[model samples]
Target chain A: MLETVATGHQAKVSAERGAERSLLSQVPLLSELPVQDLTRIEQQCRYRRFTADELIVDRDSPSTDLLFLVRGQVRIVNYSMSGREITYEELTSGAFLGEISAIDGAPRSTGVMAIEDSLVLALPRSVFLDLCTRYPNLALKVMQRLAAMVRAAQDRILDLSTLAAQSRVQAELLRQAQAHRNRPNAAIIEPIPVHSDIASRVSTTRETVARVLNDLARKGILERCKGALVIHDMRRLQSMVSDVRG
Target chain B: MLETVATGHQAKVSAERGAERSLLSQVPLLSELPVQDLTRIEQQCRYRRFTADELIVDRDSPSTDLLFLVRGQVRIVNYSMSGREITYEELTSGAFLGEISAIDGAPRSTGVMAIEDSLVLALPRSVFLDLCTRYPNLALKVMQRLAAMVRAAQDRILDLSTLAAQSRVQAELLRQAQAHRNRPNAAIIEPIPVHSDIASRVSTTRETVARVLNDLARKGILERCKGALVIHDMRRLQSMVSDVRG
Candidate 1:
């Protein structure tokens, strides 16, 4: 059954039934569902793959599917009226997209693109909503996720509005570090997008980001290794943000 | 029944039963509920009044109730690490507050304060969630409201990131204008919250907001009345934002 369902692109083959079910179980909202319910959900999902830079959803287009990344990473962004891209967020595997539009049936407000070769399980909006309605816990989980997103956005707004340019860069770096933190007291953010990408995300110029990173490296707070940026002093970085915010 | 529910100072007396029901009917989330359901919801609510500058909800406090403003206005804001106030949003009559916390059971992330003598109907969070679970349409309506808020926040992020200081001010003004626009081609933003308040909302300095408003006035695009700023040329204001955005 698994092989039959796996189609195209041997580069990133679809997961077998057991693997897919395990993947679904890893999702916070679906984690506690009974096996029967998980199977039902798995039946509704279709696996799809995208190469780097592939557009998954276009802003303002009808949002018809909920996408759960199973492999690789993606970027969520919006283009300004002048065509400047503003990165709203980035998602890695185990993260889902399109909850806002899926709940309200609104057109997509941001464009999502694969940052690397990615695999995702796509569930139609109707099926997702049905699942939420049928499972009260699912509805609560969805609401919790949305609430957390709202709080994160509010914090971003605060940072953009009040923090200075250097502070903004540090703040974003710290945020990314925390998200990817694996060590108890340190964080390694790999393939650190690009200075330009970081600038856009923090509403600063690329030069500013470059200058800030260089300063941090000189101060022994951060180090650049191969394809990643490592934060050596998380406490110092946090204090810097607090000072700027103050 | 209405009289019994009205407590504390009654400079603005509690609304009559018929009037209370009518007001609930006006709320988008409760508008379509059956009369019996509406009455049940109404029964669970109690009227409260806040004097100008009263704190409605404290930041980081446990969220205990959902508030529906029946009269006057409130501002949602967060205090920076330095004690600088940053306005996140403002709500007026017909708007409800605390749905985010009510849904997620998280602490209130921002403080809400009354800008004037205000009347509100308060519903306990547990009851509100119960209502949502029992009424699917009610739950959908709540979800729709949250979705709209998420989209608005995304737009704000875009504006703050890409627009110039002056453009940011103009964009926020245009947004507020549209929300309050009563006539086809005009909008009257009354008691235009102080310049500093507007500055915080748009992430600009008070001096910048004053300068932008002065420029608009000099260009005949806006006129200041006793307690309001009247947009004489809505199209012109709209175009100003579009031009900056573009």
Candidate 2:
């Protein structure tokens, strides 16, 4: 919905602006901007809220404003004609969406749905483009972000081209394992990553994931703990993935 | 090679700059720049030439200069650990590459090889970023170009997720046929499109492509007219692709 909710009170507006200023500071794209510039941007930003599972943006829609995730989570997804939902990526608080269409004046390529109650700040396309031009550093940052995105897509393409469905699942596990490693003190965090989510990520059916996990469990490699799979032989799992992935 | 070749004759430089001005005008990212600005950019641009089968850019290379294809053809490719080459995309004249790293300061995601004897104009990242900041339209164009890349990747991802090998091959054919239709009077262009190229594009084995083509010919859907397959059943072919691709 494009409709904006009016600000509550002047005092509350002041408090929210302060909180927003801090939140905007954490956003990779806007973090480089000065506090004054951030405040300026905050003033022009329009706010909206979406409920859980609400469709925020539809694929091929004409909406072009960049949505900054102020709170909650959203998933970028597109459904095939057969009604198969392909989840592309998920963004939590601080990540932004719709910049592609916002800059290019094109329709949205993928739809976005709020995973939970999400609050977003909609910055007009003109204002964002103006800010990018006004700051070369910001423009460079934007380019870097886009570059990262291209690399990610290239990685996915490589996986699809080089590996089969089973190898892809292992590679997906390795990727999550690496992400887990990167997080400080995440080692004891058991039962992580939903199997269905893993299936979607590897572009395979949940049945395949269940079979893989069960096979691994029989071999004393990994086991399912409650809602998630736990990797026991991490090195063996890595080798199994790299052996086929390579 | 980062080394620049010394200019031969003053008259030659003067003549080439004029041609370069017009050529720069055709580049979508730089087209919006004024004649004078294009000239200025042309002055800073360095020229390089590569022989057929020469590696122009290597995957994960630290070099980061945007290369504008002035003449001939090039292909972006990456190899699996087993040494199987997967061709990503091919570009001819008036196209460019290396912008992802040039903007982001990241390593190249894929390697570029010269398909034939080709010439390129290399623009330094700093100068390109400066021009982008100076001209919002140029930056907007840059974003649009990047957006186009993202959309292309997303489309590929969708195909990978929803379609199997056979469907992908058919989809690729449909894509090529559409591209053929878009070209003015390309109907008489029989014996076009090498089969090996088709295999590379769909990320499948050449044997699979051969089998699919043979099946289509047996069914009188498409026939191999010497070097290329002439698609006789266009509507049926499209419908077959959509039925699966959807």
Candidate 3:
């Protein structure tokens, strides 16, 4: 009976390790890490589960760990003195948060809250720094990821500064289409969350999102089927984004 | 005379080395490298000089080198099919440009041009990777810098998405004040660049910039004295930005 219990414990540990590896595999920054390195990294990670609306990272708090989203979604938000809370971005699986603060050795600038029930793997800064020092490839990958995020932010700035409202909505739809296109059997239809989530991405209100989406539907460019946003004419939407940019 | 010439040659070489050290000093990314490593890294640097309006980077071209704005200024611009050119940012001394492509080994997404006679120190991919590998602290600094740039981009996005035209201008002024504060300033009266440059940073037209500046002057928030812009009331300008955000 003692031997059997020991075996069961080992099996459970193995399963947990497997889950950690799977999560690491999904993160683009960690995708290139060797299996041994990943296992070591997994060992350094602290796993925590969060319920909906739970604050994962608080503004002004010292950031000691890098949080990687394993399942569900997280929202990055900024609250102003006027009591306006702006949702900057929605982060899903395969995304990491708090890296900037961890790297800078600074306090968190914004709050990160779970949008739904979620699991996160938090890697301590000491371990991350050690890995970065030992593995140059990992450092390069992190830099690349950060640079890409910067580019995405630049694109957002361009949209907000120059693109028209209709065009902004269309550009977002195209982004959704491309994201969903990567999955298996992606051609049939894509699942988008709520209009509110979409609104947060584009920095518009949900009412504006609904109005523009309805306009697109009326124009025969898109359709709502089975509670999913379906693109009937991708070319038209592309043109709209281009027009707004121009 | 021969001795003088020999001494001058040695001086010139010493000066070159000194300039390299200064450049290395300003860039936290290269600070932790040893002398020999820095010499090797400097060897990989391609020094290029550009006259006013010369294109350092063309949009859509594969980005091959990271340009360090060692001296003078450069402008980042995005051109559209409708022949509209929007100036995104101006990079001055000690600022880095063209890092997006260099970091990702990807194509240049925006055009960069010398707005003034400029000297740029460029590092290729191999040298960048080498530095990252040899010095982990340098890698951390690079990541931190990239993160800061990303944060700046996010701020720009927020301003564009949420703020109106007038507020965008005011926010930009506040940013300028902050940047000036970071620099070694001799006095409160700083020579403001051309209105066009300010317009670019704020995502407005030159005429609009002029109009706004004139209005602010009338409001006693700022004053133009001997071709210099003096902020008479920082509180008022900040309040203007806050009002716009609201």
Worst 10 residues of 2 chain A by lDDT: A182-191
DockQ of each: 0.54, 0.57, 0.44
Report every candidate's CA lDDT: 0.79, 0.77, 0.72
True contacts kept of 2: 0.56
Report the lDDT tens digits of candidate 1 across residue range B1-246: 122235443324434434444456656667767887776776677777677888878888985677888788999888777677778778888788888888877798788889887777888899888877776666767777777778877988888888888988888788878978988878999877588988888878889999999999999988889999898888899998888776
Residue A97, model 1: Cα distance from true site in angstroms: 1.2
Highest TM-score model number: 2
Candidates by TM-score, descending order: 2, 1, 3
The TM-score, computed over Cα atoms with residue i paired to residue i, of candidate 2 is 0.87
| Candidate 1: stretches off by over 4 Å | A1-26, A32-47, A179-193, A226-228, B1-28, B31-48, B177-194, B225-230
lDDT string, candidate 3, A108-159, tens digits: 7678888898878788988887877777887888888788787777677666
What tens-digit string does per-residue lDDT give for candidate 2 at B1-246? 433544664336458656644556657677667888877886678777788888889888997888888787999888888877778789998888988988887788899999998877888988877777788777767777788888888888888788877888888877777666533322212456666787777778888888887777788777667666577777787888878765
**DockQ-based CAPRI category assigned to the predicted complex of candidate 1:** medium
**Over 4 Å off in model 3, which ranges?**
A1-46, A79-88, A181-189, B1-28, B80-88, B179-189, B243-246
A95-149 per-residue lDDT for model 1 (tens digits): 8888888888889978898999887777889998887777766777777777777
Chain B TM-score against the true chain B, each candidate: 0.79, 0.88, 0.81
Instruction: Report clash pairs, candidate 3.
Output: none
**Scoring model 2 with DockQ, what do you get?**
0.57
